[model samples]
Target: MTANERDNIRAAMDRLLAGIPLRSNGALTIVRLAEEADVKRHVLTHRHTDLKDEFYARIRAQGHVPDSGRRLRERLEQAEARLEALREENAELRAVNEGYARVVNLLTLENTELDKGDGARVVPLRRP
Candidate 1:
């Protein structure tokens, strides 16, 4: 990387670490770093790989989690919670449906028996 580019990257890194980003959202990620530096993302990932590594190392040393990573973890937890709720709801619905099916079957059998009883009670009359 050129000296000017390296300087810009370093300054951007400092700004990001300080949470005083001028050009980016200060998310503690490489993409945000590049945005802060006013450089392309490939410039940091491909050309200044050392700087990229240094940035990550510094973040780790400081026990800092990237905002994007934190957000993803939060989203995962929420999705898992939602999935569990849906599963419980599905189980309840299945049980209710089974109950309805049993009641319907019993009612049908009773109706059939009533029809048979009516037929048996009818008498044929012969006129004299």
Candidate 2:
């Protein structure tokens, strides 16, 4: 390829990567992008050294690198944050449940102690 053609191809690749969504539906793969850019699958994989480097450099200049690893890291951070929030919620619920259980136990003990008192007992009579 001529110098200009190589530059154009690199530009196309940069544009394609930039357009990819941050959250994908499924596994992150580059076949669709390669097809869209009219580049072969092997070019995106086995023969992508020059274009991949240029693409990463350009995206990094924009303060981010575009790739599966970066996306996975971002997702992992989000998941960890969600897990932390859930753990806090669970702790709060457990504390509330413990308080309720203690109240129930105390009430039961009081009822049992009252039953032992021998004050005037009024038992209900059943008619046969």
Candidate 3:
């Protein structure tokens, strides 16, 4: 309807002009394209029918087979799976760092206590 909306639709269609391909978030389906452009599906059907037509036509022309449901979810699932793995790795690394910090703190505390031996600590002789 609006010029900005039209531009967003065109941008989305351009991504799919080569037919459905594997996009980073998901497969480049109509639904995902609309999501990418921050537009609704109805916008494509009611107002920007021209872009919609070109999108489907290009898919057919490009010899790229559509998914069975035309809603491939594997790409999104894979991305989420990787995110979860990275989160776990981050937690493990933080825990290891914390453990190292605790060890350093304990050693420092022990050195200080050792320096205060016999109740009255004596300064070590040092050359100027």
Candidate 4:
């Protein structure tokens, strides 16, 4: 009714946006919205008709502005596919790295032996 009271209702609406769940757990209801906003339900219904309409519109909209559920689902699927590809690439790289390690080890041993045979200084190999 009063300007300060209306401001309180608006503030409550902002808080409700964060507390209300999207779709999985539980949808935002007027009752839950009032609870989060710390205001009585009547404040939304009688005192501020515009706020009440906005609240219901948001619930109906289900945050359709940015990415809707369908789009989010597609993106999630794409991400999962990309993750699988990365995992496979990681496995392949590990195998290649292991092969390189074995070759490096063998070559280092061969070099050490040659150095000893020719009286050349044997340099210890440091791992990179």
Candidate 5:
């Protein structure tokens, strides 16, 4: 990319990172941001190393770097908390599902016994 394009892309990213919400379903992924900023994905993903210093320098010149770090840390902590809560919820759901599975298995066995007199076979049903 040309110097001007690179600068524009960097500025767009800075704005996106600053303005985009970090909450669930709120944050924009790198690819999405790149698309929104009209920058090539490869430039954002691979060419970033070449641009990092200049990008940081520009943002620093614009007085955004120091506060950016704090904002990033706060967002990271919120993300971690959300992840922890999701994990706990997943564990609870798994426990409840296991309970349901056991109950279903027991009921199936009892049903088999009850159907033995009719010579009925137990076939697994397919789920939609």
Candidate 6:
């Protein structure tokens, strides 16, 4: 690779690692690196594999996860928690509904029993 190309790639790598990209979006990926360097994607993938490997090594050494990936993980955790809470609430509501249903059935049976007379004739009370 030409010295000018090497210089550009190194500068791009620095800018990306420092979270200050000028040419492309600051993503810790080879595609973004190529874009940042203004180089063809295949140049980095095929021509300068060492540079690419070094970039990944530095990222790994820093233990830096991409911002987007980290945020997605956090959101997934929150969604899972919310789902669990909803499931618990749904179960409680179902239990309450079942209790209400039982109460209504018991009341209906009582009403039916009351509607059936016990073969007793109505007696008129004599007023004194």
Question: Highest TM-score among the candidates is held by which one?
Answer: 1
**Candidate achieving higher TM-score, 2 or 5:** 2
The best-first sequence of candidates by lDDT reads: 1, 6, 3, 4, 5, 2
Native-referenced Cα lDDT, model 3: 0.73
Kindly list the per-residue Cα lDDT of model 5 for residues 20-80, writing each as its tens digit: 5322222334554456556776776677655545545655666654444778999999999
Q: Which of the two, 1 or 3, has more lDDT?
A: 1
Residues forming the 10-long window of minimal summed lDDT in candidate 6: 114-123
Query: What tens-digit string does per-residue lDDT give for candidate 3 at 1-128?
Result: 58998887667666655444344244446677677667887887777788778777876787766664434567777889999999999999999999999999999998888878767655799999
Model 5 error, position 59 (Å): 13
Residue lDDT tens for model 4, 7-111: 765666665555554322233555665665566778777877888898767755766432355678999999999999999999999999999999999999998
Instruction: List all candidate RMSDs to the true structure.
Output: 5.5, 6.3, 11.5, 11.9, 13.6, 5.7
Q: What is the lDDT of candidate 2?
A: 0.64
If both were scored by lDDT, which would come out higher, candidate 2 or candidate 6?
A: 6
- For model 1, residues 34-127, the per-residue Cα lDDT tens digits are 9999999999999999999999999999899887789899999999999999999999999999999999999999878978885754368999
> Which candidate should be chosen as best, given lDDT against the real structure?
1
3 versus 5: better lDDT goes to: 3
- Model 3 worst lDDT run, 10 consecutive residues: 18-27
* Whole-model lDDT, model 4: 0.70
TM-score of 1: 0.72
**What local lDDT score does residue 57 receive in model 6, on the 0 to 100 scale?**
91
| Residues 1-128, model 6: lDDT tens digits | 57887788899999999999998879999899999999998988898888989888988888999877899999999999999999999999999999999999999887777668685544799999
Runs in model 4 with CA error above 4 Å? 1-67, 118-128
RMSD of 3: 11.5
